[model samples]
Structures are given as C-alpha cells and as structure tokens.
Target: MSSRQTEVMPNFEQTLLKKRGSALTDGLSFIAYGAQAIANDEFSKCFAPKPRNKVISYLLKGLKAPLSIAGMGIRYFLLLPIRIFILFGASAGFFIALPIVLRLKSERLKRLLFKLYCKAFLWSWGSKIRYHGKKPVLDEPHIFVSNHTSIIDYIVLSSHGFPHATVAQRQGGIIGYFQKNILKLNGSLNFDRSQKNDRSVIAQKMREHVFNTEKSPLLIFPEGTCVNNEYTVLFHKGAFELGAKVAPVAIKYDKSWADAYWHSRTQTFSSQ
Candidate 1:
C-alpha cells in the first residue's frame, strides 16, 4: 500500500509543475506585446505635426512688433490736439482770473486761487513735485530761501499750500508787463537791482511785510537770478536782516525731461 501511494504522489507533482511552466510562458509573451505597443505609440508622436494652438502662438508672436508700434502712433496723433488745447486754455484762463483774484480782499480766497493756478499750470506740463524736510511756517512770518534754478521754481513753490510771495528783480517790455501784473496780483515784491537805492527800498518793504502785515510767509530765491542747478551764486542779504524766523527750503525738479531753467541767453521764458 505504501508503494502505490508513493507512485500517485509523483504523478500529481509532475502535473502541477507543467501547469506552472505554461503560466509563466504566457505572462512573458503578454509583457513583450505590451512593450512593443508603447514604443510604436511614442515613435508616431515624434513624427506628428505640431498642434493647432502651437501654430497659432507662433503667428501671433510674429505680429506683436508691428502691432505695438501702430498702437503708439495711433495714440500720439489722437492726443496731440487735446494737449495743445489744455496748454493755451490754462494760460488764457490764468491771466483772465488774475484780476478777479487780486480784487478780493479775503486772504484765504487769494491763496486758494493762487494754489489752484499753480497746480493747473504744472499739470499742463505733466510735472510732478517731490517735497522733502520741513515745510514753510504759516503762523509767524519767516524768510523762505531756495536755490534759483528756473522761473518755474516759483510756480512749484506756490503749489506748496502756502500763500507766500516771491521777491523778483524788475524787467522791461511786454515780458515785464505780464510778469509785474502776475506777481503784483499774487502780492509779490519786485525791485530794480540796477538801482543803488533799490536795496534800501526793498529792505524797508520786506520789513513792513514781515513785521507789520498779517499775511502769508515771504519767499525769496536769494540767488536773485536763475543758476545752473549745479552751483549757486551769492545770496542777497536783505531777506536775512529781517531778524525774523528763517526757514531754509530746497526745490528740485526733473531736468532730463522738463528742464525749467531759463538762462535768457539760450532759453527764453516762453520756451521753458
């Protein structure tokens, strides 16, 4: 009985081994077919043409250069007339409004109008003001000193929310007429620098404005005339002797884009 049992066990083990070998062979054949399919798919993609969206992207990139330039040209021609109108309109409106502002006795209204005019004038030129350090004192009268760079410096100072008047030297002709009228309307003082007695007269006038009057602060570009922004000339001593509180002010502007310096020899006031 033991021998017959041993013979049956050997036949059963042999059948199990044959089944396992057949399963392993079938699995390897399936893996080889799958790998071949993957390789063929990747190879086809390498030769395929680019996608429709990619082609359109290249086309738009080629057009961007010319399209951007055309857009800028269109914008300039469209806005040119408006800028010119604003410049002339602001100039005319300034002169027209000056007389009315001057006649008003209210100091508050005068300052408000003058500030508005300065802002409008600067806006027409697309100028931007960047202020630094202490501002002008309003409670008590003080001498406001700054370096002279351009006639536009006064306009920029006027926009500083102070009703201060500027000290200017006398001029002649139509230029002088407009200048005197505008400065006088703002209650600014002008003196003849060529005259020997003018200094005494100016000193007395400044003393009265500082000590006697109850108005805005007095502003003076002590250098007298416009300097090359790089260096300053000697300052006049009239503003210093008033014995009042002195506030030193510095004014700077972007000279690269809109240089306001009017040297008279090279640049005219209107040109600046």
Candidate 2:
C-alpha cells in the first residue's frame, strides 16, 4: 500500500532527499553519484576490521584521484625557468608601465595580492599541504617552524607574507637558483651549516631579520633533515635562539610525499 501510494504521488525532490539522508539498515550507507548524492559512498565494514566491497570502491576512487592531477613532474621541473622569465618580464613591464597604472597600492590590497601569489605557487607542483594546528590570525609578526620533510615548505610559508624569513641552504639545480632569488627577494637569511664562523653570522642575521624590526614570526624547521616517515629528527636550537616563542606545527598526509599520485596505499607508504 505504501509503495503504491508513493508511486502514485511521487514527490521526486522529497523522495530523493529522504534516500540521500540516511545510512542503510545493514549499518552501512548507500552510495550514489552526484554532489550530496542519494547516499554517502564510504561506510565502515561490519563484522570485520577491514572495509567491505563498497568501502573498497570508495578507496579505489581515492587511489585513482592523483591520475586526475594534470601536471606535476614536468611543471615542477620547468617552474623555476618559467618564473625567472616571468620575473624579468614583470619587472621590466612594471617599470615601463608604472606611470600609466592607476590602481592605488593599498596596504590591505598588497597583503591580498601576496596571499594569491603564495597559493598559486603551492598548487603549481600538483602538491597540496594539509595543515593541522591553531592557525594564527597573526595580528603581529611571528616565526614559523616545521619538519623539513620536502622542499615545498617555502611555498607553504610564502603564502603568508608578513615580513617573515627562513634559513637558506645551497641550490642544487633549477629549483636552487629559482629559490635563492625568491628568498633573497623576500629577505630570507642564508645559513651555511657547514661553516663554523658562518654559523654565528647567519644566526645574527636571522635574529636581526626577526627581532630588530616589528618582530615578524620566525619560521624554522626544527628537524634539520626531512624525515623519511620516521619520527621527527633532533631539533636544532639556532631557530629558537632568536627569542621567538615556539609555535610547533606538524604536517602529515597519506598522499603528500608522493606529491601528485593522490591515491593508493602502496604509493602513500613509499612517500612516507
């Protein structure tokens, strides 16, 4: 009788809404296509620790997601050269057009532009970083520190431009040259850990960059080496000595180390 009445008086929107709203009687959810679909696709398996077939399907979807990432290896390799040309072009263009441009450079607008540049740089390599911590509103300046697991940390920090700085290291190839200029342009202090006297000089420079002015937060990677999924490496005191209070941050992800291959536990573990 209920089925017959539903069929005769079908309220398609209401009917779909109900179907999309709940878990299944078997303690699982019904999976369907579309945004906010008739069901949630990923549900826990019953009577077992591992996922059921439905869960497996959802996991597979996640695994194949990185194949969906359009560019990574090629773009990352080409990024520095491209940016170098871009920098040159923009600099020349800005100087030539400075008289003609009319938009007032507001302090608020400059900050917004800085944020946009940071986010674009981060996404260029097809890598995404998920952060877990209390995101500071940063009414004032402060230092940031993280585990140097990958070379992408600079982009992560660049997204926040409040006159912040980080320690600089040697350039290997393209990224090194591109990054050296980027950091220099942004006022980063170069630190050569291999040198004895250079260490003090570097620290003094960092202290000045962070403390001598309005006191922007210092960003440092306590673990000097990028961890290979092991526990954090021993922290160095150089970054902390500048009288900046520590704001410890941890970045962990299943797919990040792989960079672009967003799915599959096998690749995930390899990245870790």
Candidate 3:
C-alpha cells in the first residue's frame, strides 16, 4: 500500500473506534459500570477497541433460553433470598442484636457481617455481572477507597467477599453501639475517625489488617462522608496512609445517595 493509503486507513479505523467507544459511554456510564473497566485500564494498557471482542457483546452473543431461565431461577430461588436474609440479619444485628448483646463488640463479627451485607447487596441488587472486558482484582489487601455515593459501595466491594477494615465517623455514638459492634464481629477493624488520637492506634491496627493477617480485602470510603455521585470528592489520607494500594472505584448509581440513605441519617456507614 502507498503512504497516502496507510494514513487514510488509520483515519477510517480511528473514526470507527471513536464512534463505538463514545456510544457506550453516554448510556452505560451510569449503570453497574462494567464498561468502566475500559476506562480503568492502567498505563501499560492502551485503549484499543476490538470489533468482535467487546465484553457485553460476547455475553449476549449466543446465550440461549435454557441457560437464561436457569440464571433467573438460581438468582431468585437461591442467591437473592440468602442475600436479603443476610442483609436483614446484618441490619438487625446492627440495630437490635449486637447492641443488646455486648459480646458482639468483637471485630470478627463486624468484618464478617460487612462481607455478608455486601454479598447480599451485590447478589440482590447488582445484576448478574458479566465482564465484557477487563475487571478489577484484589491483588493485595489494601484500603479500597471509593466516592461515598451509596451504601452500595460497601456491598459492591464486599460482594467480592474479601476481609478488611471499614472505618466510620463516630458522630452520634451510633457507630460505637451498633455499627462498630457488628462490623467488628464481621472481621472488620472499626475506628471512629473523629475521636482524638484514634488515628495512631487505628493506623497500627489497620497496618496489621493490611499486612500481618487478612483473609480478604479491606474497604474504606475516604471522602469521609457520602455525597452525590455527580462528582468525586477529595479522598481522606487515612486509606493511603495505611500503606495499602487505594483502589479508586467510582460507583455510578442509578439514583442519588440522598435517595437511599440507610446506614446514616447523615454520617457513618451502617449495615443494610
């Protein structure tokens, strides 16, 4: 091919590439963000659209009726109820059980319940996830910080079902009594960020969770408070200072945080 033809070929291909990437952006960005994996690619990974290799396209390629029925039946009969039960259990534990029973103060329960709560949310709410492209992995137990839009971030990260500390601001003593109590029982390290000198002690504990002994991934929302998903706020240094890789997950919610405030009336991430 001539040099002129070479230049012309790239322009034609690039034009098609731009169109495909752009079309997906406007509609899919606000959903579960399976497409965000395309955006989540790191430095060594360059942006390249494969005409036949898009993630979602592949999932729907040849899926037949039998498998589709099995998927729904499984999710409803098995996955969803269990998830909902765990969520309600965790919620009750947060509001009723743990508070009445002081022994629930244990951090193990906190972490465990958080995982169950997250699992429930993902299985029940977030649809059957099919990666059309790349996906995020919990390589090491780092403080995973996200823009606090919905309580779902916890469930979203937790659905992956990894162990880690989840810190909350102990504003109304609500956290200390219920939220902190159950979260600790669930294998979480709970620290009230507002308490004086809590950072140093919590830092040591967090470092322990991140480095010493962890069965799963720890999650943190360092915006310090939940906000609208319209924009991402500045992250708190606690997550980064703990020496864990900060996995910045931008949860594009179908609705606003204000629309679904379960954990806190204003602050603290409570159990769903």
Clash numbers, per candidate: 0, 11, 26
lDDT of 3 by residue, 111-226 (tens): 55555655655544544433233335555756566677554556565655454556665534544564554466544665565576887887787778777443345667877665
Q: Where in model 2 is the C-alpha error above 4 Å? A: 1-114, 137-141, 160-163, 213-216, 256-272
Q: In model 3, what is the error at residue 197, expressed in angstroms?
A: 1.6
Distance (Å) between predicted and true CA of 147, model 1?
0.4
Error of 2 at 81 (Å): 17
TM-scores of all predicted structures:
0.66, 0.51, 0.48
lDDT (Cα, tens digit) per residue for candidate 2, span 75-167: 556766676566566546543543343256343444344455556555443455655555564543356787665555655665654424567
Best to worst by TM-score, what's the order? Answer: 1, 2, 3
Checking candidate 1 for backbone clashes, the offending pairs are none
Residue ranges of candidate 3 with Cα displaced over 4 Å? 1-117, 121-141, 161-163, 171-178, 256-258, 261-272
| lDDT: the better of candidates 2 and 3 | 3
Error of 3 at 24 (Å): 57
For model 1, residues 111-188, the per-residue Cα lDDT tens digits are 887787777777766677788765745566577898887777888888876656877877666568856776676557
Error of 1 at 142 (Å): 0.9
